[model samples]
Target chain A: MIDEKGILFILSGPSGVGKGTVRKALFEQDTNLKYSISMTTRTKREGGEQEGVDYFYRSHEQFEQMIHEKKMLEYAKYVGNYYGTPRQYVDEMIEKGHDVFLEIEVQGALQVKENFPQGVFIFLIPPSLEELKNRIVERGTETEDLIINRLKEARNEIEMMDKYDYVVVNDNIEDAVRKVQSIVQSEHCKRSRVAKQYKALLEVDDK
Target chain B: MIDEKGILFILSGPSGVGKGTVRKALFEQDTNLKYSISMTTRTKREGGEQEGVDYFYRSHEQFEQMIHEKKMLEYAKYVGNYYGTPRQYVDEMIEKGHDVFLEIEVQGALQVKENFPQGVFIFLIPPSLEELKNRIVERGTETEDLIINRLKEARNEIEMMDKYDYVVVNDNIEDAVRKVQSIVQSEHCKRSRVAKQYKALLEVDDK
Candidate 1:
C-alpha cells in the first residue's frame, strides 16, 4: 500500500456531449473515485434533487461569499446563477488519497486548470460534428433559437480540447466511460507521480 | 476507426525482475501488441530459441556493421556478445500502425531512450530489494562469484527509474501485465498523440 497523493480528474466537454450521462455511468461502476459534488446557486427542481447529492444548493449571497473567501476552486456565473467547485472538499479528498472527479462545463474547467494545472483534463467529444448536431436536434428540449447557438458553441468548444490531457470520444456511453476509467488507471502509473516513492524505497534499502 | 501512429513501449528493468517472463505473459493475452524481437549476435540457446522469433540471430561482423551504419536502435555488448534492437523492424512496424513492444535490458533501454525518446519506457521493478536478492538466490544458476555481482548490479539499476516514464512493480505476473496494458491504452488517449487528428477534424468541419 503506497500512500501516494491522489490525482484530480476533470471531465469536461462541449455542451450536450453528455458529460452528466458519462459521469453517472463512470460513478455507477464501483470505483475508488469520489465525485466532488459542486455547489451551485441555481434553484433546485422540486423532488428531482437532493441537497449535497445532486449539488450543494446555496443562496446567491452564500455563493458570492465563497467567491470572496477564495473557497471556490473554480466558479462561474451562467443564466443568472453561480456554480462552482468548493476548494475544501477537493483538498480534503486528495489529501486522504482519494481521487476527486469533477464534471464541469468548458469555461469552468479552464478556470479550474488555471488554479490546478496538474489535474488530468479529459475532453469528451462527440463521434463527429454532424452527429453532435444530430444529438442537439434529437434532444428536442431547445427550441429553434437555442439549437443553432448550442451547436455553434459546441463547434467552438472542440477547439478548447488543446487544454486537455486526454480526449475520449463519446461515441457511446459504455466505450466513453471505459476510456475515462483507463485514463485514471494509467495516470496513477505515471513515473512523474510515483518516482519519489520508489526513490524513497531505495533510500530505505540503502540505510 | 482512427488510423493513428503506433506507440513504442519499452519494457526494461534490473536483472532477475523477470523481464522475459512478464513480456511473454503480456504477449500471450489477446492484445493488438506486436513484439519486436531484438537482433543479437549472441549464440542462440540449444533448443528453446528460434531465429527471427526469439531473436534475429546474427554474426559479430554483421552486428558490428549494423552499429557502424547506425541501423541499430540500441545495442550493448554483454559476455562477449553484441545484443541490440535493429531500427529497421521497429521503424517499419510503427509506420504500419502497430504498437511495438520491446523487452530490453536497462543499458540497452537507456540507449534506445537516447535515440528515440518518444517511446513509452516502463521500468519493471521487483517488489523489494530483499525480494530481488531472494530471486537471484533462488535461480541457483549463478556461481558464488556471479551472484554477488548480479545483486549489486540490480541494486544500482533501481536508480535508473529517473530515466523511465513509468515503473511497474513486478510483485506478480498478472498485475504487472495489467498495469502495462493500462499505460499503453492511456498513451493512446493522450492529447499530444491525437491533437493533430482532432485539429484536422475541426478543419474538415469548417470546410
Candidate 2:
C-alpha cells in the first residue's frame, strides 16, 4: 500500500473565472492545505505583499543561479518578471504532511503535471462566457482592451481542459469549493493506494 | 460550447453503502435525471414492487433472447437470475435530454465502461468498514452470516476503486448526493465535448 503522503494540487483557470476566490475559500475551510509561494525575479509592486508569504521576490541573477543549479522545478516569464517554483521548499512541505496547492496559468500547470505525474490537475471554468466577461468588468482593475485580451486568452485556455484530471465550474463559490474538497478526499481512496493497504492487512491474517 | 445533451452516469457501490438512499435523494432533487429500470429474470418478491417501473421482470428465455439479439448492453448472473441493461431505452432517454443512471456492481460498471467508453463511472464508498457493517446490520433483513458475506464482498469490491473515473465517499447522505451532483455537472465541461463545440464556433470566424 502507498503510505500516507502529501498530495500536490494544481489549480489553473482564466483570469476572470473566480479561481482565486475559490482558492481562498478552500484555504479558509481546509486547515491541512498549504498554498505554495512562487519565487520571482521582479520588483514588488506597490502592494504590501510580504517576502516569504505572498512570494519570494529575488534578483534576476539569483533566479538564474537557482535555475542553473537545478533547484527550480518550473519557471516562466510573464511581462518583465520571471516566476518559478522552487523544488526544495515544495518537497519539504510535502514531507511535512502539507497538501501543497500550486496556483498557476495553464502553461505552468502543464509543466508541473509533466514534472510530477501524480499531481492532481484541476481546471476551473466560468459558467458561461457572458458571466466571465461580466465578472472581469466588475473587477474594475482593467481597461476594455485588457478585458478583451483576457477573454481571448480564456478561449485558448479552455482548449486545454482535457489535459486536466478534473474540472470545476465556478457557477457558485460554495459549490465549487465543495467540489474541489470532494475531489481531494476521493483521490485518497484510489485503488493503487487502498489495494496495497488491504494486501498488507491480509498478510497479517495469513501469518 | 458543447450542445445541451444529457450524459450517462454509472454508479456502483458495495451492498451497504446506502447507494439506493443517495440515488433517491438525487432523483428527488433532479427530475431531469432518468433512473434506469433494469431487466431481470428473477421473480418479483411479494412487497408491492411494480413491473416496468421498479424493474422489467422477464422470463429466463426472454432475457436470453434479448442478449442474443444484442439489445442488452451488459448482463450478469446473480443468485440464479440474470440482470441486464437495455441499450435501446437508455439511448432513447439520452436523446430526450435525460441523463440515465445505472446502479450496478463494480464488475457491471467495468463492463459498461468498456462497452460505452463515453459513460461516466462513479464508485461510491462508505466512510469506513465499521460504518458499512453497522448500516448492513441496521437493515435487519438478513442473517449474521449473510451480513458477514456482504462485508467480505465489500472488501473485494473496494479493491476495484482505481477502475472508476470518480469515487464518492458516502459519509453523509446529503453531502454524498451533492458530490455526485457536482461530478455530473462538471463532467459536462469536459474538453472532448466542449472543445469540438468551440472549434465549430470558431470555424465561422476563420472563414
* Per-model TM-score of chain B: 0.90, 0.87
Task: Give a tens-digit lDDT track for model 1, residues B51-109.
Answer: 98989999999999999999988988889998888999888889999999999889889
Tens digit per residue, CA lDDT, model 2, B1-207: 345577889888888898888998898898878888899998898998889897899999999999899788789998899998988879988887678988887778878877787888788887677778889999899799999899898888877776777767788988888878876766665555555555454333433
Give the lowest summed-lDDT range of ten residues in model 2 chain B. Answer: B198-207
How is the predicted docking of candidate 2 categorized under the CAPRI scheme? incorrect
Off by over 4 Å in 2: A1-3, A16-18, A25-32, A43-48, A77-81, A125-162, A167-195, A198-207, B16-18, B21-32, B41-48, B76-82, B110-114, B124-162, B167-182, B198-207
Best by lDDT: 1
* Cα shift from native, residue A149, model 2 (Å): 5.2
Across A11-114, the per-residue lDDT of candidate 2 in tens digits comes to 88887888788999999999988888899988877869889887899999999999899787689988988999987878888887678988788888888877
Off by over 4 Å in 1: A43-49, A205-207, B42-50
Candidate 1 docking band: medium
lDDT of 1 at B203: 56
Top-DockQ structure, candidate number: 1
